[model samples]
Target chain A: MPENKDYLNYIDRTAPKSPLLKNALLAFLIGGLICVIGQLIGDFYQKICGLETDSMRTAVSVTMVFLGALLTGLDLYPKIAKHAGAGTIVPITGFANAITSPAMEFKREGLVLGMSAKMFVVAGPVLVYGISSSVVVGIIYFLYKVLIGG
Target chain B: MATRLGNQTIALDKSVSIINTATVVGTKESEGPLSPFFDVKMKDAEWGEETWEKTESKMQKEAAKLAIQKSGKTADDIDCAFAGDLLNQCISSGFSARELGIPYYGLYGACSTMIESLSLGALAIDGGGMDTALAVASSHFCTAERQYRNPLEYGGQRPPTAQWTVTGAAAAVLENGGAGPYVTHVTSGKVVDFGVIDQNNMGGAMAPAAIDTLCAHFSDTGRSPESYDLILTGDLGRIGREIVINMMNSSGYNMNDNYGDSGCMIYDIEKQDVHAGGSGCGCIAVTACGYIFRQLKDGKLNNVLILGTGALLSPTSSLQGESVPGIAHAITLSNKPGGEG
Candidate 1:
């Protein structure tokens, strides 16, 4: 074993020297491209299906999630995510990939333990917290509407 | 005179030669820089096996058998086999050993198993315990990922600092005399920990140990950086390689042009998308066997130093918040007369 100080020094020196500016630029480009694709899909849905605003929004979300899963299944999302970093991961497609990736991986383990149970390993927390917080917010909105006679 | 030079190094009185080598890699590894040098590249992940673990065992078996055959020797010619892998109980090596039917020493040095086996194999031969020995190490991406990190289906995002575990196996035959690169010296390393708990950044955890072994080798042998044509670190990746260079520079050994890391050199990082680079017991094993062995045989490189570094952290150890301790063992392979290059 080396002296504590010497080991610490080497560890410090060896820490990753990430290119922050370059990564941020790539993230911005990729994230923006993903958002652009989402908007384009939403526009296509509105023009083609003639759905109302809220329904169109839901359609777009579903479409994006489907695309995310499709890309992830093809193993293309990870490749994109490798370069795009958080850009691809922060979008609806990222969530789709999160759910789809585990499901595909665990499919070999069988549905009960592998697919069904492990599918939510990455996105489960996000889904839980996001839905719970939305429910609480919905309750507050309902109470406000009832009391204020709006 | 005692071959023991300094605290960690031993200068072998009898030369131990690398008789032959064989390397087998998975599809992903076949896309790397050293792919052309591998003996066999499997097109399928399953490799006709039902499971990834079985496939890894198959790889080990094929590599060991192929190496012995390439050396113009049968399995009966190999006195013992030193083999290991990342799997629990080293089942990959054990299962392969059952097939090879040779006396086996199942070693575990994490990613450093290649050099560990080589060091032991050479020592056994040099010490007159064995005339011919085989050393091998293997790792599979799927098997290692499920055991150490997450299931393949978990779809967890790998941080940029995380390295991709190699799916490959490499085997070498070391004997008393052969027309090949010879093992001349070895520096066994001591375990050192810098208290790095993040398993993703293995290169950081292992840098100190590599430096310790390298420095000790130099001090004990009274040899400088200029002695070797290349100073190779096994599976240190990009980050740890830089740290090693910086430490060596500060210590007054300027190893600028002749330094290489097997982990980083195996893949073209930008082209391959292997972020930090390749790792595993197979990383060094394959590179040393395929690339270094070829270069030395062709006399492109006269003398080389190989340091295999391993981050000793199990799944339980990481979860328990134990810092990753690391170790690195070094061996000198040279092409000079009487193996003194």
Candidate 2:
């Protein structure tokens, strides 16, 4: 019998490659569209809502997150993501979907153990890394400031 | 007495016939190429069930009932049932068996459960342990997605190598004596892992096992690829099917002309968005019970060899970075009884 590694190599040689260029192009366009929508929302908050810059940014994020969760609830985001690939994943809206999708799926398991616990099933690692990296960066900044007197 | 052939194959002495079979599939499969061959096609995936798990159980139950009904046998007449599904605890088969109320053997052979059950059921009758038995296997796309890959509404991209889990169930009634379409031989497979870890490319992981079993069946029975009218692999999608053909050719067995795959035949790959093709336990079960069984009954096919391929990977195993081990069980169905030719 052939070694497992050799078999894996054979499979790798024979398996069809994913259409990387097409996927990348689709992701770029769709991700760009999402960013443009976020920018438009920010502008709306700035011009019409009469909000401060910081408050406007928060409002824009909130609106975008709401839209993402709504689309996920309506069962439309997954269909879009099927074609959009990382285009849906790179945006903050994707993060919202990550949380909402599990919540909706696990709802049958009940609210506490099912919905609440599994809500972060997909996004849990994101939050963990995101917060951990921020803390590490904060420590580095603190050390640099103290030692260098900046 | 069923005599053991070379190493892996067992040639049954008595006739063990697949009296009847029934298949139930979801709307997506109903729209597929083999739609006309199925016994029941659900209007929707949900089928008025509150959960996908429940829907799968319901499909299995309906299929089992239909199979028994078609065979002119009642539930009480069946001595036992062998059933399985691609759920966390094999809950779909368990629930269906509970409703069926026959002496049950709940199996977990991943996608190979269909043939695994059939092989066991035929063996029991051949061994005189049972007179009549039912073999059932089911899988629902929604249930499998949530259990194995992701939630139904999750927005994630699947690779082109990924297969669509078939939403269907199939049941076959096997009796100790019948006129034709007999289970003449069985070659049980060993778990063979090629160290493939990609969960998306299940076909790649499963192809080696199918090849192993097919080779064993041929050597044990002293048969060649041309001995059978069709040599079908269960749920080895296009890529896996290609791999099998290449590997078999290198092994000095030419199966290019007679070889077919249930996964590729289940759906129209060009039109259907199923990238690799249909998969899961239901892929083979429905194809065999619906299309192949009909063809065999209509005299279009005389002798057929079916190898049900399964990638034995669980969510926990995949998460732990374990390689996917594969297995395939081969069953030979012939119009003539064993030892005739």
How many clashes does each candidate structure show, in the order listed? 2, 0
lDDT of 2 by residue, B1-341 (tens): 89999999999988999999999999889999999999999998899998888999999999999999999999999999999998988999999888888999999999999999999999999999899999999999999998997778889888888999999999999999887699999999999988898988999999999999999998999899999999999998999999999999999999899999999999998798999999999999999999989988998998999999999999999999888899999999988889333
DockQ of candidate 1 compared with the true complex? 0.24
* Tens digits of per-residue lDDT for model 2, A98-123: 99999998998999999999999999
- Per-residue lDDT over B1-341 for candidate 1, one digit per residue giving the tens place of the 0 to 100 score: 22898789888877689989999998888998898899999998889997788899999999999999999999999999999899999999999999999999999999999999999999999889899999999999999997887656433446667888989999999998776588889899999887777788888789889999999998998888888899999887887788889878999998898999988988888898777888999999999999999999998998999999999999999878888999999999998634443
Q: Least lDDT summed over 10 consecutive residues: which range in candidate 2 chain B?
A: B332-341
The digit string of per-residue lDDT tens for model 1 on A60-93 reads: 9999999999988888888788678778888999
Alpha carbon lDDT of each predicted model? 0.88, 0.93
DockQ list for all candidates:
0.24, 0.66
Q: What are the runs in model 2 whose C-alpha is more than 4 Å off?
A: A1-3, B339-341
Listed per candidate, the RMSD to the true structure in angstroms reads 3.9, 1.3
